[model samples]
Target: MGLVGRVREGTRPPESLLLTAPGERAYVDRWDCDVAAGIGLAHLIEAFFTSKAFRAERLALAAIGRGGTDGEALLLAMGAAQNFAAWTQVERRENEILLEDFAGRTRCWLAVTPSADFTTLSFGTAIMARHGMHAAARSENLAFRALVPFHRPYARALLMSAAHKAVRLRQRAVSGG
Candidate 1:
């Protein structure tokens, strides 16, 4: 039951997916967990969206809009307003789901690969500064640059928390609790 989170370097979105610019700065944070049983990619995606962690993240974003403190609030506000349903599905495969925002500046992928004993579920997100006059993107980049020192660990922790929530939900479902 070990769940790990890491900052993936030089990870880019699929070439077929035209979202980020060639020279734009992008960051990828991934969380991996081993599930007791194989879970379909669609099920995993549904679990992720329905997880308490996801709900909390949305609420936090709303709170930021209503004046929450700290760097997270500032970063979220500078990025994009919260709209989970607004994220469009770009691709869906047997073990993966790739989603992008309507404007195509942000992307996320959730996948589940079954192994001999357990299934590995991974969630990754990539955010890039949009082209043209994007004040919000610029501000987000500035804040991200300024917060580089704390970004890796902070992102890891956030992903890990979400992964834990998913695991708990799966457990409860299996136990019929």
Candidate 2:
């Protein structure tokens, strides 16, 4: 079983919209915005993965690794694409989608939930950091900790960007455009 699979087997909320304890430090950040009525869980996931905002974020991270020795390499090693399939699908319901990915000393969970009115979408992420195996790993965790404060707004913008895309796609689908 993968890291995510193991997490799924543990004692945690099956459909938790945030990350839980069991690590050295943890953070749970969420962003909520209005979405179209036709937007579903699947649509949200697809939109998020394919959105320009996501691509931009990935590029920015890659840029951070452009020049440097160990630090650059470590930052560059963080691949946005790897997380998509690496995350184990913990829950999938009519209005919610939950996925968890645990790689190295970091365990993260992402949840997307649509409000009862189908007009509000909430995107949440829970990240747990642990001790690493080597100096590079330790440095990486330290960097992550240092950047935590900036994460909330970045996460919110990313989710909102995807939500907008999902709404557009839904409108297109409904209008046969």
- TM-score winner among the candidates? 2
lDDT of 2 by residue, 1-177 (tens): 110110111224434534433344455555666654556655566666556767764465447542123222222222222234335445444566555653534333434445465555566666666555899867876787788778766777667677777777677778899
Q: What lDDT tens digits, residue by residue, belong to model 1 across residues 1-177?
A: 444333233243464233332435365555566666555564466566655545655566556553223343223222332334546566555677566655576677676768887776677666665555578767777775676566556545544554555566567767999
lDDT of each: 0.55, 0.53
Q: What are the models' TM-scores?
A: 0.59, 0.61
Model 1 scores a TM of 0.59
